[model samples]
Each structure stands twice: as C-alpha cells, then as structure tokens.
Target: MPETSRPAHPLSADEALRFTASRATETTFFFDFDGVLSPVTDDPDASQPVPSVLGVLEELASRVARVAIVSARPVSFLRSRFGSLEHVDLYGLYGLEVWHDGDVVTEPAALPWVPAMAELAERAKAELPQGVYVEYKRLSVALHYRTVPHLGGEVERWGHEQAERVGLRIQGGRMVVELKPPVDQDKGMVISDAVLGAGCAWYFGDDMSDIKAFDALRAREAVDPAFFGVAVAVANPETGAEVSSAADLTLDSPEDVARFLADALPVLAR
Candidate 1:
C-alpha cells in the first residue's frame, strides 16, 4: 500500500465516490464485518462494531438502494450486532446464509454439511494446539490463531488436512483458516448478484477473500461503462497491505470507515 492511498484507477476517489453518491438510490454498498465494520481482535467473540458504524450504516441504508454485509461470519453472529438496522441485509458465511425481510434463508446445498462441520469442530478442538481458538458456525468452522500467531503454520496445515479429509472447502484469512461446504459461493458471487440492477456499488473489506469482491467490481465496470464501483480497504496489521494494494482506496481503521460513511451521508442525501 502507498504511504497515502490513491485510486488505482483513472477516476479519483472523490470523483468516483461523488458519482455514486449522486445516484444514491440506485447504488448498493457491501461491507465485510470482522475488520471493516468491527475492529479485529484476538478474541473473535469479543469483536464488536465501532460504536458509531451501525448508526451510520442504518442512515446510509435509508439513502441507498441497498446496504448489505457480506462476511465470513454466520448470520446469527452478524444479527447479534446489526439486527437493529432493519433495511440493511445480511449475507453471512459468504452468502451461504442470508437474513432479509425478517427471515433467515440458508443455501439448500450447504445444509447437508452441517453435521460434518459440527464433527469437524470437535475434532479441531481436540487435535489443534492449546492456543488456537475453534469457532464453530453451523455451516462452517474457523480455526483462529490470532492469540498465538506463532502457531499459524501448524493451524493452517491442520485446517487444510481436515478440509481434505472431510471434502470441504478452505478459506484462509489474517490469522485464521476456515473449513466450509464446497457450495461455489463467495464474496465475488454475492456482490456480482447483489449489484445486478444498481447503477453504482462499493465494497469495503480487509482480507484476502475480499480481493474476489474487488474483481467482481472491475468485471462489472468492464461490461457496463455506466456502472461505477469503488473498492475500499480497511487497514490492519495482518492482510492490510495485500488487501489495500487491491483496493481503490484504503482507510486507516474501522473508525475511519465510520467517519467515511458519516461524511458521505450528506452527499448521498443530497
């Protein structure tokens, strides 16, 4: 990432963002939860959204065609923090589960793997190192090594081995590795489908998986010259440089994300 973040494309940040704001009601905004809305922490369960982000997102949702969080987390985990924002949709576990219009809808294909994932969770807890944290989402399992960064290589090896053993898919992040059903769904597919009719879109994220979402935006721009897309990255010690390098612009932190939205509200409302 550059010392001062700038647009990787021809259009400047102000120019592209302003263009999107000008078409607020025809635009959709997608965000990642862990490091984009909430600060990354050693304890995954303790992670919470920045105090002001939810309020700003609620206000932004009111102005835009749609506001959605497309994250690696489960819908239940996302809802615990964002349920108050009625208009904001939730696409959790990378779109394997969705919460929209007061109902939770999970992908039919992913349901069959629930028991396998549950079994994998227990196996992980028993087999993995003591410092590693095993987070079990019904459709997936995350082996977190943030607290014990030194165990990353061991955890990753174990995770991949388990994934292979169970015929599941693997996703690697900052200091965590996850095993999920091989359903062919990801942030890219989620954003590609979600931005179908929107004139403009923006995706904010802070991990390796988010690069696919950035690619989706670029692909949309290639086909539709009229469609404007912005990819914003939130900085973190892990995965920050890589994600930022792929983004249109980089914000310093989740607090910066909150402030960015707050500042954009006026332009969007206009």
Candidate 2:
C-alpha cells in the first residue's frame, strides 16, 4: 500500500539544515546524476558535474557511511562521466547495475533484457516523429523531445504506443519518454536495497522517476521507524508535477542541492 502521510517540507535553509542535523548519524545520501549532481544540458552527453559539486560530493562521501550516484544512464557511461570519483558508489541503469570497488555488479536477471530493449529503441527512433531523439541505453530507451518541444504530445503518445507494442513500461520525465522492461528496477528499489539494512537514507532528484525513491524511503521509514531520512527534490522549472508533490523538500536548483550537501556534511560529520 502507498504511504498516505506526506513527508515534511524543508522550505528554508534553516529548516533544511535542522532536518539534516537531526538525522545526521542515520543518513546515507543518494543523488541523481543528470540534474542533481550534474547540470542538465541540451546535449545530454555534454552534461558534467561542476567542480564545486564534485568537491562537495567528495566531502560528503568521506563523511557519510554510504553515498551513491543513482542514474538512468548505463554503468559504463557513468564510469566515463566520473572517471576517477572513487569516493562514491555508482548505481546505473536505474539500479540495474552497480559499480563498486572498481568492479561492476549487475543484477544478472536484467542482463538478458538489455539487447532486446536496445533493439526496441532503435525501432522507436525510426518510427517516432522527426525531431524526437531516441537514446538507446541498452537497459533502457529514452525518447527526448526537449529539442522539439512542439512535438511533445506526439512523442509521448508514440512512446506509449511503442512501449505497449514491445511489452514494456512507459516512464515519463522532463521532456523525455522512456521504456523499460516490466521489472522491479526503480530508484525506490535501489534505495531500499542500499539503505533498508542500514541506518538511514536520503535521496535527491529532479524528475518524476525520482518520486519512486521518495515513496520507497518513506515507506521504509514507516515500516521500520528506526530508519530515518529525508527526501529532497530539486525544483527546476521542468520538474514534473508528480515529483514535486512527492518530495519532502524542494530546492531551487542543482546549485542549491550542492550547497545543501556541502553545508550539511560538516554538521553531519560532527
């Protein structure tokens, strides 16, 4: 059952700080890549983490018992993006793959579905509207219409049609449509696996896909009161309605997210 109670809001810097300090000892931070740690961009491949963002994450990772980057991108892609950021663990393909201790561990169950998903995406690229760009991530497929804003509806409709035709599930985000196998691989499952047996879990994201993680965290807390944490959503203009509604606290932007983390680490360390 969905947890009926909404998580508390972190409206101001003071409230956010107090929330963090209160759960400091139990918290384990999980960040989304595209718009949480790294800035979003027209060219997804060009999006990289700002220097200050990386520095703050490094510091947080050092202080926290667990710090992970959970992204929809493939594990290898994340590895390439953050080549030597050894401090943080990488949960890629939306928790389908985990890069830990210089090695990659993927859920064997998800491996066989990758090639089939890639092929489906390739077909989507050919069938979708002219400006709709298909991103083949092996484990998942994303149709981006941020470039062709006018065709957003068509992109979504076609994405859904294709997902249905291919027996996949549709996942929508900021100007993008995604198709993934009907598996239990989501940010929520990732957080549950990573933090369920641990002290606490805090997840930060800026898109609809992230709400799953927020829901998961809260549900876990409800079931196990000892598991305490926060759910932070980056408030971008493009943030989805569902994501905003599900978030416990909303920050102004990725810059604000980095600043919050930077400020909280020192206090949490104590």
Candidate 3:
C-alpha cells in the first residue's frame, strides 16, 4: 500500500500556484522526471521532456531558491536529457548519483554494487521476456516492462530473486522494477533535504515510488502546518489513481505542468 492511501481533497491549482508564487524565492521545488516532465514512452530511450518543459525549468530554476530533478534514471541519461539546464540539480537512480554544474557525484559506498548490476543486466537480457529490457546503471539495474505489461509479475519475481542474492532492494515504478543498493536515500529523503530551512516546498511526481515524497510532506506538515509542502500528481492512465490519491493537487498532463510553470512566470516576475 502507498504511504498515504487515502485521498486528500485535490488542491486548487490556481491557489497552489499563487501560494508558490508568494514565496517563490523561499521555495524549493522538486520534480520527478519521467511522468511529470516527459511523456511516458514504452521505450525509455524515447523518453524526452516536452520541448517546452526545459525552458520552463530554466525559468523556475532562476526564480525558486532551488530546483531539483530526482529520478530513477541514471546520471548519464539524466545528463543527456537535461544537462543544458545549468541551474537545475539532477539526481538519478533515486539519489545514489547526482549531477550538478557539470560534475557527477556518485555515492562511493555504492561502487561495490557495480559488478552485480552489470551481471543482473546481462542475466535479465537473457532471461526476461522479449519486450522486457534491462537498464544497467552501474550501481543499479532496472527491468522495464512497459512494452510487455503482463511481464511485470515475472520481472518483479526475477528482480526479487536477484535483489536478495545481490544484497539490493526493489523499487517499483510504472511498469518498471529496479534493483539498487539499500541506500538510505529516496525521493522522500531528497525532498526532506531540499526543504531544509526553506519557507515552503512542493513536489510533483507520477508513480508509486513517489508516494514516499508525498508522505514526507505529510509527515512534515503534521508537525508544523506553517511549513507547507504541496504534493502534485501528474495524472496518467497507469498510475494516476495511487499518485492522485496521495497528492494534494493533480495536473492533467505534462502539458498542464508546462502551462502551470509558464503561467507562474508572471507571478514570480512581479
């Protein structure tokens, strides 16, 4: 079950954006890459941010105290897709690796997991279904099943078997299962760190894995309601139910996100 199973009333986008605008400089904004910024593609290789999204990110990065792109993708992939945005901090593989100002910093402790990830990737390539492909991220391995949705169960089982043998953990996302070292970091931890000392924060995401961040916001707000943490769900057919249920707000699509950011420009500018 997701951390926050019950749905809170959806936040009014207008009010939420305005709230963010009011504290623009003191707000730290975090976003999940795949579904929140890019249109989800069956082929991960084809996953790219909407043409206008990057420009919006650049704008927001300039206005917000900080902007981060936290994702399950590898730092290389995140760099390739979003490196041009110099001001944004990019965290990949759920924060085991981070890229900022052209330098990529990977957790030194995660180095030992490299060989196991490589081995699992090779094994998955041979053992998994035809449409199921493995992505080797050096410190982690992800089995993608978007092209073969029914293969999700098989992939999950195989991932579990490998994780136990390799001393790793399973992180499930939309039609994807990842094997990574049991790092203490997650999207929630990332959000917690990002919001430190900030007046307000907001996170936008579209997967069950993202529930951790929503729960983090809930945890924080429960302690101090003045420190606002808004959770925005990017509506999608596959994972919208759980994501929206946990989110304080829901946007229809990546295009809606782009529009939200675009509309937010004037608010922050003034």
Candidate 4:
C-alpha cells in the first residue's frame, strides 16, 4: 500500500485483521466487481476476475455467512460473471437489482425510465466526442472515454448534462460515466440493507461511487457498537487517492486483493 494515502478514519491494518479473526463466520463481505476483483480494462468486455480472485471468492463464500457484490453493472452482467460462485449474492445497478439463485429482481420504478435511456444512447453517438462511445445496457447507459483520455472531462460534463436532461442520475466509475434512473438505490443503500444482522462487514472498491458504500460501513459502526466494518480501497491513478482517503485500508491492485483474500483464509479460519 502507498504511504501517501490519508484515510478519513480507519482501523489500523492489525486491528482490522484482529477484528475479523475474532468472528470469522459472522463477517459479511461486499466487493465491487471492476477494479476490485478484476483489473480495469479499456474494453469492459475484456475484463474478468483473475484466477486467484475467483478461487479466493469461492473459498470465502463457503466460509463466510455472506459474500456479495454490489456494483453499477446490471444484474444480468453480474449474474453471468459470478453465478458459478456458491453462496454469493449479486446486487447490480447498485441496489436497483438483485440476482439471487439465478432469478432477477428489479425495482418496479426502473421500467418507466427505459425510453429516456434509449434517447440518451442515441444522443451519445451523435453528439459526444469521438472515441467516447456509449454502452447501452438494457436498464442503463455508460459513456466510456477511456480510449480518449484527453476527453475525459468533456465526456463527463456532457454525461452529466445529458443525465440531467433525461432525469437520470450519474454514477462516475473508472474511465466511464454511467447514466441511470434517479431511483433511491445506490451502493450505500445496498450495503445498509445487507449488513443488518452482520457482526462485521467489509466493502472493497476502487471508484468514486464506492465512497458511499465506504461511508455506509462507517455509519453502521455508529449505530451498533459491536459492529465492525472495514473499508478497503484499491489503488488506481485516477480516483485511488480519494477512495483510499475514505477507506480503512488500501491495497495496491487487483493482484493484491487476490493475495489478501487468499492469505486471509487462515486468519479467518482461526
């Protein structure tokens, strides 16, 4: 981990490890798929969890009471990626969707926003900067500006403008800007609901939107004295500092995340 990060407030690494070791099975794990489990790629389709990450998740799912992924990606996408991992819960589009036991559960309010989403997709192609293309997921749209690094700010500004016009909210993730319905769902709400009865909860992420989830973990501790939460931020050049500053601990990369999980098995087993 880099020594430059200024975490908002976090348990020391030793303290967090000791706490998790104290009550292994009572711990619930939450992770963001992109930049946490899988390295961020220029092409989203090219992204997949490293083999070590997949194996570690499989093992953790068997041992932990709950292991969930709450991400901006759609339920269908998450289902395809993590469906094989046993005892894993998938919440996509933040909390607007839930894919459990192979069934998809979506909020009713999201349906009416479909037409507007389509219009945004069209406009993105016709109006946005070149190399800044729109990825149309059925329920939402993501404007990717990764291939055109210099146009990031312009794409983001345009994304926000379009989202406002379409009455959708903007979720800023790695190298992309997502436009989705202004529903009451987000990573924060997802974690808040999932951690209800958990003795300890950990959320690992590496994006601007993930800060909300990190805050949720911290907030739960204030409400329940015995609740232990760990906010882990993965280091990336763009928003790594911000995420790390808000996290309990910072890991160097997806490889480190895999190693962390693989190494923690024994500690958790104890």
User: What TM-scores do the predictions have?
Assistant: 0.95, 0.89, 0.92, 0.93
Model 3, 64-90: lDDT tens digits are 888888898888988888878889999
lDDT of each: 0.90, 0.78, 0.83, 0.84
- Model 2's number of clashes is 0
Native-referenced Cα lDDT, model 4: 0.84
For model 4, what is the alpha-carbon lDDT of residue 145? Answer: 89
Clash-forming residue pairs, model 1:
none
Q: Per-prediction count of colliding residue pairs?
A: 0, 0, 0, 0
Q: Output the worst ten-in-a-row residue range by lDDT, candidate 3.
A: 1-10
Best-fitting candidate, scored by TM-score: 1
lDDT of 2 by residue, 83-112 (tens): 667788999988888999888998887778
Higher-scoring candidate on TM-score, 2 or 3: 3
Candidate 4 TM-score versus the reference: 0.93
Worst 10 residues of 1 by lDDT: 1-10
RMSD of model 1, in Å?
4.3
How well does model 2 score by local distance difference test? 0.78
lDDT of 3 at 45: 81
Best by lDDT: 1
Prediction 2 TM-score vs. true? 0.89
lDDT of 1 by residue, 1-270 (tens): 111232348566677666776677788999999999998988999999999998999999998899999999999999999978989999999999999999999999999999999999999999998999999999999999988989999998998888888899999998999999989999999999988798889999999999999999999988987777899999998899999989888999999999999988887776
